[model samples]
Target: MPAKRWNELSPRTRKLVVVGATVDAVLRIAALVDLARRPAAEVRGSKRRWVLAVTLLNSVGVVPIAYFLRGRRPQPA
Candidate 1:
């Protein structure tokens, strides 16, 4: 099957793609910032591994969400 060029995509499709990409980027940035500020011991796994996964893996915001949900331990009030 032939791949469609950017111009070939419908306006709605293009808007959705752009919105998705923006959300992904925002989530990744938030995750990275949190990782950087939090201590290694506060994280569930090796901070290095989480950094690599969050930065490299393209999970459509899933990876970042996982990092926030499962990677870090709860902080004391």
Candidate 2:
């Protein structure tokens, strides 16, 4: 299907889209910052691979969420 232009979207649809994009951006940034600060030994897999995946994938928050949930090793109490 053809994509609708921004002006053509209804107010509710536009609002939803904007909110979704904002949330996705926030998640991505948070994930990236955490990845950068955390040591390599604290990460589950290759840091290079995680960087690529987190930066490149447009999973609408899935990739970032995965990075937080499965990528990092738990810190000692």
Per-residue error at 77 for model 1, in Å? 2.9
Candidate 1 deviant stretches above 4 angstroms: none
Residue-level lDDT for 16 in candidate 2 = 99
Q: What are the candidates' C-alpha RMSDs?
A: 0.8, 0.7
Clashing pairs in 1: none
Candidate 2 lDDT over residue span 1-77, tens digit each: 99999999999999999999999999999999999999999999998999899889879999889999999999988
Output the lDDT of residue 9, model 1. 99
Over 1-77, each residue of candidate 1 has an lDDT whose tens digit, in order, gives: 99999999999999999999999999999999999999998999998899899899989999999999999999878
Question: Which ten-residue region of model 2 has the weakest summed lDDT?
Answer: 49-58
Count backbone clashes in candidate 1. Answer: 0
lDDT winner among the candidates? 1
